[model samples]
Target: MPASAPEAPAPALPRPLIGWRLLALFYDLWPALALWMLASLCFTLGYTIAGHHDPHENIAPLSVLQWALWATCWLLAGLYAVISWRRGGQTLGMRPWRLRVVGADGRPPSWQALCARYAVGTLSLLAAGLGFWWAWIDRDRLAWHDRASGTRMVRNPKP
Candidate 1:
């Protein structure tokens, strides 16, 4: 009888390039924007119902209420990110590009890690994306969040 042929090993998964990461972030911004708008609408309605003189007046800039609105938006965005990462390791935006967040061992990360990732990612954005840009110089091509959270984003192989 002829010997059976040896099976080939699977190919190594490659890390996603910065361009892909940026594209996913850009896609995610749309959903985040929509959520922020909804939150703003609710805040505006509450402000008007509180007996403000003008029904159509905008929330006063730098007021306590305004600060609350900003905080709500930030929390909401963080929830969106943490939940997505926890549930499936991929957000809506990451789905299209096949990007997934995994721990150093390549398994789903912990909730704490996911939150850390979101927090660091927020700082990265606030710093003009310098954290994201760090991947360019990183030997492992990891972003700031990746390093801080001990998580990494990797591209899945095509099915």
Candidate 2:
């Protein structure tokens, strides 16, 4: 009799582990801080170019511009996060950490899901970051944003 063909192996399931999440967090934090620094520099330069005798003198305009820049940065970050998450389940941060975000059914998240993720992420930071910390205690290791969006961050199966 001819030799029987080998059976195919079962596919691996996604795992949302702590180490990967922490690594992703670390990767994300530096870029966010860099953006903040850049925004501050731009604000200072704008104040100087406006010919204010003292940069501090034009407090109102500076405040408004500063807020605008900050909001813009946040929007950019959210867009980046959503696009990356949906396309390959990994952001620049998550890629380095070998982490990926996927919906509950192991599919790419929808646009609405992405919005939920970003909204929760923003609120998490605003509220002393408890939402980010939720992953640490949650049984499934999902952050608050992941929970709200019906998504999960898991170790990427492919290289």
Candidate 3:
């Protein structure tokens, strides 16, 4: 045989199993909950101060206002996820699990891509987590959000 160049090393797998990603999501909830609490406190204080009412009164908050609070919490959570992924390709939870999010080109995703992923991921969760569950059966083990955003959650070995 003619002299041939040595074969290049194969790259690491870019897809982690559903459990790790789910664990990451579960771990991420702590921060999101903290943000939501902080935000709700601010909203409550503002509303009470505006109405000149005691903030500690046992009262049912307005439904409309409750919805607004939910929206705010959702927005903050999305920002947290997108920012983390954009800056480092991993969040606090993903770090512990040695997981990373990368674009189809194997680089950090664009802001637009991250936003899309966050949005679709929310939808997936709202729909009983079918989107995340998709990974379990997918031939390539990619979630709906990953497929939609042209991004994938990759698994990395321990350092």
Candidate 4:
């Protein structure tokens, strides 16, 4: 019988370390901030159009409109994250860092999983980043959102 060539081994997954993840998060903040500002602007415009004609008047802090603005900003940021993750696994911030989100099975995660990730990540931040710190102690180096959503961040090899 003729000898055949050996099959190639599968490429290893490039798991990103916590430091890299943190850097990416920081980078991502710029875009998120922009989104928040945009949301705030729209809310302000609406308030103005609603006959709040005083030049110096603004949306009162702790008012329902202000709360709604906060919620809108949050949703906008979530949409930015989830849409980026779903479409390409990498957000603008993640691109420079070469970080990409992948499912546990090494594929694009479902919408539900992505949403869960965003929600948990928000909670993590609200908790003073304790969830992110969890990675340092986690056996697999996965954060709470990662474990909760069955998704992970992988560092892409340099070109």
Best by lDDT: 1
lDDT of 1 by residue, 1-159 (tens): 999999898665799999999999999999989999999999888888888748766767799999999999999988998999899999999999999999988889999999999999999989999999999999999999999999999999888
TM match of model 2 to true structure: 0.73
- Per residue, candidate 3 scores C-alpha lDDT tens digits across 1-159 of 899999998886767889999999999999999999998998788879789568887335676677888899999999999999999998888998999999988888999999999999999999999999989999999899999999988998777
Candidate 2: where are CA atoms >4 Å away?
1-12, 34-62
All candidates: CA RMSD (Å): 3.0, 4.1, 3.0, 1.8
Ranking by TM-score: 4, 1, 3, 2
Instruction: Judging by lDDT, tell me the better candidate of 2 and 3.
Output: 3
Better of 2 and 3 by TM-score: 3
- Regions of candidate 4 where Cα sits further than 4 Å from its true position: 1-8
RMSD of 1: 3.0
Runs off by more than 4 Å, candidate 3: 1-10, 58-62
True-vs-predicted CA distance for residue 48, candidate 1, Å = 0.8
Query: Worst 10-residue stretch by lDDT in candidate 3?
Result: 57-66
1 versus 4: better lDDT goes to: 1
Of the two candidates 2 and 4, the one with more favorable lDDT, higher being better, is 4
> Who wins the TM-score comparison?
4
Candidate 2 local lDDT, 1-159, one digit each (tens): 999999997675666576676678678877767766776777777778877547665446557776887787787677777887777778778876678777888788898998899899889878887887877888877788888989877676665
